[model samples]
Target: MIGFTLLIALVGAERIAELTVARRNRSWALSRGGVEYGRGHYPGIAAAHAGLLGGALLEAWLLDRPFIPALGWPMLGLAVLAQGLRWWCIATLGRRWNTRVIIVPDLPLVARGPYRRLRHPNYVAVVAEGIALPLVHTCWITALLFTIVNLGLLRTRIRIENTALRQAADTTPASP
Candidate 1:
């Protein structure tokens, strides 16, 4: 349980790091005329993520969720892999990477890194981590609820981002 708690704390720290990066990137993007989309859902996204970490701790401690070695080890690996993928997406996007959909016109969609194969690799990391993190300590309830909430959030999020991308592309003038 002590180890699991530390793991969650580490994940929380990682989330803080991501938000700090996102804040800096958001400012950079906006300064260069980046238009943000889907601001409304950002709060829900933050809440759901916070809930994931908190719920896992509460459920594991209060409900006495035991760590099954077979499940825990594999889930831990997946969580770590998800973290790697998340960072890859961040590095690939660089200053353009943000928690909110902020598109700079005339900039073509990223084609390198994980973006080459996955349209939304960051979300892939989010989904994978959400599941694997909770399941690490057998917090099945948190895993289930968080997954359900994220699916709804992602559906809206994806639609807004695609529309924003299309609009930005249309607004950008074609090269001579």
Candidate 2:
């Protein structure tokens, strides 16, 4: 259980590092006259993520859920998949991908990589991991709580991201 807690902490830290980089990138982009849209809920989104992660660990221990070997492999796979998609999103967006909402006018919306498929592939991966990772050890409380919270968060998040994308598209001048 201690190990699980530590693991969650490490994973959370990695995510925080990503956010830091993304924020720095966002700052650079904004300084160069980059457009920003739908940024009001960024802190809320971050808080929710952090809360879910902490809740997962707390529920796991509080509920005294024991790790079940049978579910471990699949859960590990899902976690790996989530991390892969997340990095793919980071790479695909390059400097444009930040934790905060940012859109640069006249720049084309990204359509390569994961964006080529689902409009928000990263979120898809996140949703999957949110459930699977906690269920790995039969931490039902964690799984249920995070899923419910994430659903609410994603609802608003997707709308904001999509709106930004559409705005970016509408503002961009048509190519000759």
Best by the TM-score measure: 1
Per-residue alpha-carbon lDDT of model 2 for 53-151, expressed as tens digits? 777787788888888878866886787788889889989988888877788667787899999987888898789888877776677777787788789
TM-scores for every predicted model? 0.98, 0.92
Off by more than 4 A, model 2? none
**Each candidate: RMSD:** 0.7, 1.5
* Tens digit of per-residue lDDT, candidate 1, span 1-176: 99999999999999999999999999999888889999999999999999999999999999999999999999999999999999999999999999899998678889999999999999999999999999999999999999999999999999999999989888889888
- Residue 57 in model 1: lDDT: 99
Winner by lDDT: 1
Candidate 1, residue 138: Cα displacement in angstroms equals 0.5
> What is the Å distance of residue 152 in model 1 from its true position?
0.2
Candidate 1's C-alpha runs over 4 A off are none
Predicted structure 2: lDDT: 0.80
